[model samples]
Target: MMSTPVANHEAIEKVRDLIQGIDNAMLTTMTSQGLVSRPMKTQEVEFDGDLWFLTKKDTNKYQEMLKHPAVNVAYVGKSYVSIRGEAELLQDPSKVKEFWNAAYEKLLEVPYDDPSLILIKIKAETAEYWETGNKTKMVKTLFERLTGKESEETDLNKTVDLD
Candidate 1:
């Protein structure tokens, strides 16, 4: 089922916090045959309800996004975040240069100025996240479960609207 959409600032902040660090995210795109997922380097920038990734114009994902813009990006770390959004293929050279670095140069073996290089901007619509809280919260949750009670401490998973 799809999450109820709410443009709450706190939820957006929570999402940004959950995905702050960690480098890569699994970008899943809809193909003509089925769904395909691949690990792409998550750009080291503020989340702000949107996600960005660098790619080549000739990649299959580029074509998939053109045909079907819906996509999911999953981040696994201390917290797990699954973000759903509509993908847009961008051809701004200046923006690409802004996110370029030595690692991308070494990994992609393509210069930032390459004409084929492009940016995939995911305008996130809804996000669901699971966070592993501190020991105190875990203990509280355990106690609540033992006592047959439900509380905020026991609720570690939630769906947040991004758009």
Candidate 2:
């Protein structure tokens, strides 16, 4: 239940550290059929209340963003993080070039100047993360669960307000 307020710098910095090296995030978007998730490569830029991803307008995710802007981004690496936010489609060419790399160029098979290429800017509202690196905490949690008693020390789970 520990939630970091928006004004705290530690909250945002911790979130950035957690998701720093994650290659891809599962972006969950709402659609008429319900929620759909897809693996999307996040931009290398540090998290500063916003997350960016490169996508093409021809994709279903882009269309879904048009219908519903709410989305969730999940990252699993050293820790598990869940980011809730609203999405905005952008055609900022300069930004595309900034994050673009040879790998992207090879995979997309098109230059960064392609008309369909677009950026998805996620205005993150909150980030919830769980650190699984502590084995002692995990065992204690399991014991507590078995005995139906809560521990004084809480799990290494926190919610950071990004907005």
Candidate 3:
């Protein structure tokens, strides 16, 4: 299996790019019964290793977090990123205004001040990422083409590990 560039800053940047470029992510939260997942709209703002979303405090997701704060955020595209983090329900009006978007008003049907409206803050603790045709793959492809040798597609899933 190929070793992921876990210590490489470039690799981290690539992972962040994938996460930020995506508009939707699967937020997996633990419920008293079992794991629950929901499609959530990612806020358009800087990540800084944290992901934020707007929601209602009365929603099942909020209730679930009150019981269990551990969460897994999944974003997949040409690559995949699985982020393990803790989620907290935030009620700060300033933060709400900072991440607020007019689109959310229409999407959630809740005003900024609606008592139910809340900010879900996910503070990532660890992450694992894998990509197809990233730098390493491109280099291999170039070398094989120059040598008139056919290259086999690499399996990245077998190469990834997280703390």
Tens digit of lDDT per residue, candidate 3, span 42-84?
Answer: 8887666578988987689999999899999988776677888
Candidate 1 lDDT, 91-141, residue by residue in tens? 999999999999988988899999999999999988998786575776678
Error of 2 at 77 (Å): 1.2
Instruction: Give the TM-score of each candidate.
Output: 0.83, 0.87, 0.74
Model 2 C-alpha lDDT per residue in residues 93-158, reported as the tens digit of each score: 998999999888887778988888999999988899888798678678879977999877575588
Question: Which parts of model 3 have CA positions greater than 4 angstroms off?
Answer: 1-14, 134-163
Alpha carbon lDDT of each predicted model = 0.88, 0.89, 0.76
What's the CA error at residue 23 for candidate 1, in Å?
0.9
lDDT of candidate 1 at residue 147, scale 0 to 100: 91
Q: Which stretches of candidate 1 lie above 4 Å from their native place?
A: 1-7, 134-156
